[model samples]
Target: MGRVLLAAVAFAGVAGTGNGLMGQDVPLAADFPEVYRVGGFDAPEWAEFAVPPDVRFDAAGRLYAMEGFLGSGSVVVIDTDGTLVRAVGRPGEGPGEINRPTGFAVWRDGRLAIADMGHRAYQIFGPDGEFERFVRAGSVSDPLGGAGSMGSKLRPDPAGLSLIAQGPPSGVGALTDLFGELLGAEAPGEERVDDRGLERLDLRGEAVSREPILEGWRPSTAGAEPPELSLDDLTEPAGMLTMMMSGQRWFEPGFLWDVLPDGGIAYSDSTAYEIKVTDGAGRAIRRLSRDLHPEPVTRRIREEVRERRLRDLEEGSDLGAGFRAGSGGNEIPAGIREATTEAMRTQIEDREFHDVIPVLTALRATWDGAVWVERVGEEPWVEFGPIDVMRADGEYVGTFAPGATRMPDAFGPDGLVAFVELDELDIPSVVVRRLPVKVR
Candidate 1:
């Protein structure tokens, strides 16, 4: 009775209905539902690449799209009449080789969690394909560390005494974000009832930090007692609800916006230029920013600074020990000092989005709501401006075109949206984005 992957298709059609009061448990869904998209995915040729990382929708609705990474990766089964039936994994890591996979988690009991991210790990494939169990995950790159780094380190500022009075700011931390799309059955009696605990986790043991949030998109209804809010009531436009965690990382440091409505959000905030806004009581209300980027990249330095001046008076001036003078983090070394100002204060006080931003690595989604913004360009080629937006105010609402590969994790049941097409990387295309809002 608990497996309903996605019957949520909403965007601008429900247009009106916010008064609340019917036993008021609040499941009419839309605490902060924003809706926006139309990146449906299109590939007619170009040698074919597909490049999907995550997307889901099984339960008879069928719309799965996984395609590991780079050519022939596979996991693209789409049908509702859309056809393209089989394309499961094969790259080499064992059991069918899918070492690069990155997104898809649909388990209420239906089971389907694939987030491989180049073998960090998470493998379960069955709706018919068989071959389950893999888990692993961790180190989504510097989980949290600064100075020496092993994770959770920082304290190194008081050296010159200009601020050498240290007592509180010890190594700057608090952020522990692991966005696990789902790891195993958490309730209904768990020990390994299997629902996804995948035999009770341990291959990595971070399994997205606790895993709960979707009981009706929980934020504050379960117990209610948290609505102080500040930062502009939490993003105004109406506030509360966000997820912008790496719409893709060419822009880096921005993505994962979920004003905590639990529509399942991940706006990626890597370090920070910040824009949080979590409400359904998840707290953290508003934090847009005085300079969240209107120019010169805000979200904390959008990564793309190349300033050269290596006057090789003659190849290290006749090498000897070669100290070619002129040191600036040694030429474009992924540099951006001040260690991202407290990683933007743990992404607005301990929420910490990640991988910084610039995603849309060539879009994918098709259970029915459509979201394939692979290159809705305007100023992108080296980096900056992959341009993306798939606003799921409820499900398939509105807005999709900014180069979005919208698949932070799960989606697939009724609104179906599972994409992967570039001559079909393994083959997956469920496209059902028929929205205007009918979130029922």
Candidate 2:
């Protein structure tokens, strides 16, 4: 069974230099080791993978992948050697049917806990892929007066399951909400905000306990102040309001976390090169650090990001023409659409950036008690980069260069790793591989 050492360790002292914490620099491997490709698009039709696949491995090394389209999806089970084991669930509202599954987790006993947006509940399936029961999650009213289910993601927990629920709005609120309140609509209750947090839910879906995990980036102005608005702004078009509220600061650091196989939580909450591992009760047990120089956000970098942002907006915007064509009468005026685009451009141009790029970009805990830390690449905008592998007990294994290795979408037992790949035609597939022994 997978286990993480729970012994507390001394916190490493910070370095006087702004570079990073005082620890050994992760040495990069000259090249990635060979891996066996066991599964992919070549699999049977019924076992084919889909876009945005969510995968997990049970204690016995079986891979369970969840994939589907708009209203349909299912979990495909595969053996360690790429053989299809079984398929579970279907698209429907009935028992065992899954509609719009957002996230899922595999229990040590091989049962599945799925977060279904369509059902607004957590559904539990037996080890034999039979639907057992579901727990209806709580809902919260948004500032715009629309209620949405709080559950979005699920994490494995020894006591039960960890539900990453949505929290309340921050920094004034969305422009749409402000407009609704100004128009004399009843405001959202304070109880909704108070209800927000990480909920430990039992199999019955009742909250056994609740606690705050970590905060994420909230919308704010360039000067770190809330946006000022006037009553006159209420008359603005919906497109403008939406665009104004959608802007996010460039390269802002947010919480990156994952649950270890032993129920310990591993997380990186800052821009520093530090990671903390805590037991199920949230007490710190180990702290990992590394020394390195952070890449500065230069003027050229800012300009490049701004250009890319603007280009993306232009490419994505249809000037509301498509909406008008489809919705039949609630069309956004051309002027409003143009103004929205301009507003977005301004937001991107004026967006503030951090002094240095965050030390790590992603964090994942392997089923075998290892944590993979994805470091920022030379180009901050690029998603994939080099990775630093370390054991749960704070032993820094080493680093893999971006070209030398590709981070697996899911890590499994016995040095097994799975990557969800896409073909030229956007056809999705799951490729399973065994990691090199030394790296594992």
Candidate 3:
């Protein structure tokens, strides 16, 4: 599977400043103490292993890490004390093999659900790591519309009886049509607005309910109309083509959400520092808010964003390699590639941005029913920033500083949090930490 990295905008920070619903200011914690770490250069047992991007914890507190990213397409099982339990699956299309493991979850009954992109299906395994069955993609009806597959991504609900299936982008067809037209294909049909929703699927990959659990959400976008072009413009297509193409604007308020342990949902739909919690049946239960000031998108910030995008284009660092491989080994004409690059550059230069940066950038729900909302940082190119911890019932926990105190990649039982890290030499590792009692 291919991954696209976006150029993040740099910003300044005002750490530990937020007024919760209780009207009291809560400051950010300086750091989180590490309990233990695995798979680093210093660890001889795991020195050769690469830390996977997807991590989870079962009811038994055993950490499950997918090795699909850099290792064999298997799932690694590790004990809480950093002991290697075993590995399940391998690279292949056989009954017990996984081609490309994208996302996975542990069920309450000890079964493992793995979403395999290469196989285009969900692979199920027994608690003892025994392969059981495969649920092909597109077997279930999409809550948004038509026959929709899970698209190689899913999260186990709090009850572990169903999975939250993430569908494709709402305007993906429009984007497809745009690309088709560029390639001299048929024009796209009318734009669609009903395809923005998430469905609840059972362990068998069947829809639990025909209606979607979440819907009617869309990303914000700002760009000039695409200019007209013809086949004549691509006579010399070749060279590297770099561009920023998406339906979302830079630093804009996008969808931030997570599945709560109680089968509820926590999400932020606007730019404000407010979060809404809905019941398992999709009814609004409560709203959590904090008085955190939004950062203004100044002229300097806009110019900086534009320059960063243009710099990526000039360096051909983001999309050139992906575009080449996506062409199926066929080289795009030099003239067409150059013309497309120029057009993309113009669009990036003329791109408009939100007046102010969104207060929250990411959201995660823990097994204890607490929602961790990551606040935007002040530094440039910072991915994980300070996190605001709060209960699902609107109780304010507090905030933790970025650096070593940011939110964990996966929250486990008994106050355990997992962080996937990389050394200076690019070797991957998984760091386990125990959260403070008050925070956890």
Each model's lDDT: 0.31, 0.63, 0.64
Ranking by TM-score: 3, 2, 1
Could you estimate the TM-score for every candidate? 0.22, 0.75, 0.76
Number of the predicted model whose lDDT against the real structure is largest: 3
Candidate 1 residue-wise lDDT, 102-197, digit = tens = 344443233455545565555666656676665544333432211111110101111110100101111111111111112221122211111110
Show how many residue pairs clash in every candidate, following the order shown: 94, 0, 12
Best by TM-score: 3
For model 2, the run of ten residues with the poorest summed lDDT: 190-199
lDDT of 1 at 52: 34
Q: Give the TM-score comparing model 1 with the true structure, all chains together.
A: 0.22
> For model 2, how many clashes?
0
Cand. 2 TM to true fold: 0.75
Model 2 stretches astray by more than 4 angstroms = 1-43, 68-71, 139-152, 159-199, 205-247, 315-347
